[model samples]
Target chain A: MKVTVRYFAQLRDAAGTGSEQVEGDFRTPADLWTHLCARHVFPLGAADLRVSVNARYVPFEAPLGEGDEVAFIPPVSGG
Target chain B: MFVLQASPLPGGADLLPPGDLACGGVVVFEGRVRDHNEGRAVTALEYEAYEALAQAEGERILAEAAQRFGPVRVAAAHRQGLLQLGEAAVVVVAASAHRQEAFAACRWVIDAIKERLPVWKREHYVDGTRAWVACGCHHHGPEAP
Candidate 1:
């Protein structure tokens, strides 16, 4: 399966790119994220991060599939 | 207009969309960029967002506010990219049958937007330093195992 992973805020800065495409058979978003952290050391971790699948906020355990858009959301500061 | 916009958000007496005859009041809130924070002299702020997620979640929040505070129409817009100090970073407006509902709905929209929206603010200080603010889904530094 393939998924498009997007990063926002500081994570984007840490990763040096906002989005990327990856091929994996991860059962959950957490798995995909772990793969990313291995490739690019994101400054934040699971406890301070929120995962979203298909643009809706989801738990790290959320299922993943081909063509899914998975985003790692950092703490938002907008008021 | 639950939106993630690039320009300044609009306000004033015309804050709410017209047509509701029962609109007895409209409440508005604008969050501005401050000149300083934590003893750092701030110059400006740059906001970034996951547009797709932010838009979807922003709309959901407005819809929820309207549903929870019955008879109210809620709209909110958050800015992206660089924002000068004192500029409006976000604006929320609510119109309802009365002032109470209007105020309550407005408050609900802002709170939900802050916690749920996928927007991030970066503070540029006068000393040539910049840092991302800790907000939204998480706070604190790295945690223990």
Candidate 2:
């Protein structure tokens, strides 16, 4: 399946782009992270990053579908 | 329920028309561009967002506040483009029949904005580096070995 991933903050800088499409057979969010970090060097730990599907936040165990919009959000300390 | 806007001039975040005398209490929180972040002098800030998602979230926040405040007036506007330190970027106002409701609803709105909104901001430092604020999701750094 192909999933669109979005990067924010330090993750964006490291990835060099805000979004990308990756080809994988992942069934969960954790599986997707393994697939991504295996290919690219994201600046943070997979556990510390947050994931969202489409526009809503999701858990690591959430299932994926083809063409789903997945976003990797790092912790923000802004006030 | 006004959402993403430009030229929210004067009174910066407090853009609502004069409040009604019947509104016994009005709670407002203006989120300004702070001077420092993680020990760096922030020269300025730029905010960008998916307008469609932002608008939807804004409306959802307002709706939730109204449900709790009983027809109270609510206005939330966030500035786009560039902003300097100490300038207002977000203005949230909640008016209700009583002070308690106004305060609680106002707090809820602001918290929700941070936790749920899709807005993204990049902080420009005086030393010439910028960092985008990674908000609203998990923050991970390498899986445990």
Q: For this target, which candidate reaches the highest DockQ against the unseen true structure?
A: 1
True contacts kept of each: 0.82, 0.16
What are the DockQ scores of the candidates, in order? Answer: 0.58, 0.17
Looking at candidate 2 chain B, the ten consecutive residues that score lowest on lDDT are B136-145
For every candidate, C-alpha RMSD to the true structure in Å? 4.4, 6.0
Q: Write the per-residue lDDT of candidate 2 for residues A40-72, one digit (tens) a residue.
A: 897799777767787766798999999998877
Q: Write the per-residue lDDT of candidate 1 for residues B55-130, one digit (tens) a residue.
A: 9999899888878998888888888999998988888899888899998888777777777888888999988889
lDDT, residue B17, candidate 2: 63
Candidate 2 lDDT, tens digit per residue, B21-115? 67778888778888886678889988766455567767888888888778687877767667887877777788777888878877777777766
* CA lDDT of each prediction against the hidden true structure: 0.82, 0.72
Segments of candidate 1 deviating more than 4 angstroms: B12-15, B136-145
TM-score of 1: 0.92
Candidate of highest lDDT: 1
Clashing pairs in 1: A76-B135, A76-B136
